[model samples]
Target: MNRRHFLKTGILGAGTILLGNTLSWAGEIKRDVPIFGPDTKTVGGKKHTPFIKAPKKVKAGEWFDVEVEVGHYHPHPNTKKHFIESISLWIDKLEVASAKFKPVQGAPKARFTIRINKPGKATLRAFGYCNIHGLWVSFPTEIEVV
Candidate 1:
């Protein structure tokens, strides 16, 4: 075969392999996205879902404490095999804070002091990730900023 033809074939093969790997990685990300149920009545939901604690009303521009705890009702496992990995807090579709925990040492909980500058309704949500159970999201908690 000619040198030019061989080089062209090699480049095309490398591109195809990279493209296939990219597609496979994207599929894995889609499957790893956070999931949640409508409520926490089930055992799996209670163990994996994150619960948010905040005030019902707050003044604009004032910082307040927001607590996010994974498995508020039912405690999740803290062993090396199955444990909570991280916790994140989101306000109105924007991620404000996050915390990471080591297995068997740190708990999946965080406190974020945040404030909104605008006066309107704000929605707060928490996301929790487990080593075994993947990701889980909490129900939205709405607060009014006067």
Candidate 2:
């Protein structure tokens, strides 16, 4: 075979291998659903934890505001390459509200106004999705209603 042909084939083979590996890596990252808590060992885990600001106790039939944020303790990337895509609020298994974000426009934060007519106990949970990272859920926050 000619030298030029040999070099072209070698380069093409190497590029194909690299592209395959990169695609597999991206697929692996896309499959994970992470749950973050206060005991974050890695900086990423700590930064991904959903920080919820809401009253521990509330009155029945009264409306209240709950704020949710990502990277509360540590800041996450907000650039076009890596950024928080969405933040969602849920009561138990039922989702309450969600906020979407763009690359350079919005932060990973949202405020939800909710009301419970009956006196009972409720659980609040928050979810955040990153452009590079997969889904992340916060530790459950219990609220008392009287």
Question: Candidate 1: what lDDT?
Answer: 0.75
Highest lDDT, which number? 1
Off by over 4 Å in 1: 1-34
What TM-score would you give candidate 2 relative to the actual structure? 0.73
On the 0 to 100 scale, the lDDT of residue 111 in model 2 is 89
Q: On residues 61-113, what C-alpha lDDT tens digit does candidate 2 reach at each position? A: 89999999988878888898878999888776678789999977798988899
Return the clash pairs for model 1, or none.
Answer: none
Model 2 per-residue lDDT at 28:
29
TM-score of every model versus the real structure = 0.76, 0.73
> Against the unseen true structure, what C-alpha lDDT does each candidate score?
0.75, 0.72
**What are the clashing pairs of model 2?**
none
